[model samples]
Target: MTDSSPLDDNAFSHIMADPALAGSACSLAVACSGGPDSMALAFLLSRWCRDNGRRLTALVVDHRLRQESAREAETVGARLAALGVRVAILVREGPKLTRDLQNQARLARYGLMLSWCREQGAGDLFLGHHLDDQAETFLLRLARGSGVDGLSAMSPIEMRGGIRLVRPLLDIPKTRLVATLEQAGQAFVQDPSNLSDHFTRNRLRRLMPTLAEEGMDARRLADTAKHLSRARQSLEFYTSQHLNRSGRLYPHGFVRLERATFLEAPEEIRLRSLSKLVSALGGADYPPRFDRLQRLMKRLEADADGAGTLSGCQLLVRGGRIWLAREPSAVSGPVPLEGVGSFIWDRRFRIMLSATKKWPKETDFFIGALGIDGWRQWQNSGREISGFSILPAFVRRGIPALWRGDKLVCPLSTQKSDHWQDHGIEEIHLIAGELFGKTAFSSLNMRTM
Candidate 1:
């Protein structure tokens, strides 16, 4: 808690000791913005990586929202380079921002950074979200009427697309970060946008002092969020257990739930189970609204054979079970593939196209859902597909299929790897979304970090 002390090795090792990072002796990357928070983090990581005999890189994302963004990115690169850390300046390209500027920029920033990590073979990406950021996030989600999960704020470690997002400084104070930079004689830049009242975060930050006077200090707010995070962890554990017991997740990216068994669980578990089923099946980035989920739950309780749709997923009560599948109408349009390449269709399936001797050079190929028309074609063809015939009709409608315009090239059936090879595709590796591997809930280890 000392104001002027620099980040010590013990504090830094707490995060490095994480199980996710233990085997990740590969290079590490940090998102640097030239701000005190990120700069201090870069300084600490450079030293740690050097001592640990691992490489470290600083990734500066130039969002280009402001005219000086590019220059600031270069300045950050220069500073990190001086600290003996390799630097990569990533520029945000394509499409002009028109609305929801902050959110859009944030998404773009992460997209650029994560893509870099994947390309560079870095398995861990460190961030500089400190105690104040957690407190601000808590207030922001609270004002928006967030549920327990949302109010829990940021996690200390998050796994996204094979990359470990490690926030070692989440429990550290911003003042300490600034003091660290000062103590090291390191210079940092202040982003002008942060001072603007036009953003909600800035407004909330300005109100922090006043709120602290009213006894809702950053430490108290962050501690409350930590407690809620533990509660969310407990809820997630039960939700996972309930889902495993009551649901059967298929490789086709749909889930079948025993209606009575699912409904027999506690109401909170039921809601969370539904959320997980729909979110993963529909490939949605966020969960559906809590209010809408509650309404759906009530309807399911009242009507045993009810059919409902929410967040791009359809829920049908058929026979004695509940079926969750992507809504046919919400399925993404065909993705054109020129030749041998891998593509993610509807975010649910990974489709890889490999060229064979029979692969036609003049033909155009695409991947899309089978839909009603394709389903009919499949049915009438009398192909007697082993697995296709057994799938529920609603589930069949959303199955990923290979297409040449209107002609159904091939159905990406789970049991038909040889079938795809016959169509000049050597392999198509398809993994259903992470339906079963629900991550354990985590919070910052305050005693260590």
Candidate 2:
């Protein structure tokens, strides 16, 4: 932890040596906020890229919440440039101040950064959250009575859509980053918002010293986070394995799982298994609340049907199988397919369409908008309108396609539906919501063909 040596250099080298990154020339994007921790990360990553012949990009997100945010990003960009890192600055503008502004700002910031990484073809994005931050996050989650995953705080690596997010300095100390930055003659901007008591994190930081006095060292908290992370990873792995073995996709836009199998596992495993089952069925927007999950589990053990609904997803236990279903939204209606607009497909998905006279070449499945009419015409010819009457009217818009597999297929809901027989080229792009109860779709990694 010498001041003269870059603390993050060791970390960056170690991460590069990881089997995940070994021998592969991948572009790396660093999320820098002009803070000491991030600045040190950018400097070290820049040097590592230079030595390893890998491209490095630095991203600074200006939340635009504070008046000085733009200038701070510029200063951070200048500092990164001095360290030989290419920098990209993104400014997020929105309401100046409001309830939950911090959370909104965070979403916007990450949204801009991740979107930039995708657009730039970066394989991985690096963040500079250190041990102290992990400890703080753990404590906060603990105080809020979070589950194992929440208690796990931050993960070292996470896969979103197609981007791999890696935090190489999670084991390092914030003090070490500050010392390294100081020794490097780097001047980092101290965000005044961090010191303000307006945020829960700030309050936790203020209380950390007292908590540490009670024999809870920040290092110990960091260790706790690591332990939780390991435990969570194990639980998730087991859950995935079990789900693959026991879960089945059924018609009627529901996924079914054996209730007995889930109930027979250990409580933790049971909870995780159920959660994962619901998540897989719901897509990215279905995070089961702990209380709701507990209740659901109890009902599953009972003979009667017990159901829970959250964020437009429904979980029901019936006839020894648990079914997860997405609710149809009142917003379902046909709108003109003039150009690009977001159409809510039930509650679990939104379809975004960008139409052009000439085929707009990009990733995502595309089909003729009139294909639905063709299907109707075929149904009329075959006298199959009776069964087909139950089907929702398909509006002509842009071709339906996910960001993966350059094939025009039916919407995910249609694929999940029981009566979805035709896989024709329908001019509708299905933008599925977060499968878990996460609010933002930006966290998802969109694959390009």
Candidate 3:
């Protein structure tokens, strides 16, 4: 192989010279896993720091999945320390093997790394993902039939979890990194799990080369990812502007432009707008699929009396106006209120006891669950409370009882009294439904959730 050490130095200098990296006095924290790619990154950053008079730190995260992870972390730390770079080792302790566990571990790894960087006064975290990783990601997303945002793959730089993540080595090839490590006599730990066919990423990496024989290459794939990223960014910008201009917020929900506004924009822009609105209200986790979004949008235009639900929010077409409402909790059972305790009636409604001393007088709703002593006292005073008392049979069977003042109120299913209604009891804000229509919901769900 060509002398990889010189090539590593050249690549490092090139990245530092990039306009994106210039003018930031931010200290750099290289995420070193002791893998060849990360080791190469550590070496490059160390050299760059010495030349540019910038501070560099190597962060080694031990996921502790393997028996040797702690050893590996120490070995990597020593290697970086030998290069005159400060080293910080982070150990992540967690569950094993399962997909969910792996994801949780990944999150913990980044969280710990970023937290350490923040504590050390570092502003940027440098990752060591190379062009091959990007290309593999794009192919995997494409295979899943993801939309523009998914196809965009990993970004060169992204702000995540309050830390700026910069992939300075994305343009370089993994082979080149390995070669550099070999030339530098770097002893990097190889994670055997990477070669396991059981992982989807590994499967994709294995297949990419065979598929590349049909004229695919990392450079071209990376370029496609870059293009998709730009397109996704532009669409997001347009959607935000459209919502700000035409969206109206109500006490319980918000409405985007009337049907006319959606019909005016191009299909892509309209879909993007709808996705944004749904995401804003439902939280990022709620995203409806594309076909569902398209069907909902068509229904809005063609079926004047149509209504649909997506992402746990409901969309209603009434008399020319579109209304989005949160779905009421589906739990139909009654909850017996007893003294002060936290009760989750439906999966949605949660009630807890607050001190009467601190209770606000102007509160909209109050449901009382008093013990016998309190009930007898209120009863002697002749307090007027609404609703029937818990059935004697239910009380006998230890079924939950609801009480208002001294009187027994209806079961948990009963609606609160008018006095409670006037206090902001009846209206609950549901996340806004997709008003930009079906396509937007679909695209947003694919990438975000």
Best by lDDT: 1
- Give the residue spans of candidate 2 off by over 4 A: 1-5, 8-11, 21-25, 207-214, 249-267, 277-288, 292-449
Candidate 2 residue-wise lDDT, 49-95, digit = tens = 88888899999998877777788789889988888889999987666
Q: Where is the poorest 10-residue window by lDDT in model 3?
A: 391-400
**Global lDDT scores for all candidate models:** 0.78, 0.61, 0.61
For residues 1-449, could you state the per-residue lDDT of candidate 1 as single tens digits? 22446677677778667765444546789999999999999998888888888888999999888777788788889888899899999999987787988899988988898878865767688999999999999999999998899999998877554456888887888988898888789999998879999999999999999999898988889999999999998998898778777776665667777888989998888899888777767655567888898999898888878798998899888787888898888887887765565555675665656654434456666778888788888778877555667667778888788787897866775444665666655555334323334431111110110
Q: Summarize candidate 3's per-residue lDDT along 70-181 as a digit string, tens digits.
A: 8878988998898898999898765665566556677778878877865565767888898888998899899899989899998876644234688887777787888887
Superior candidate under TM-score, 2 versus 3: 2
What's the best-to-worst order under TM-score?
1, 2, 3
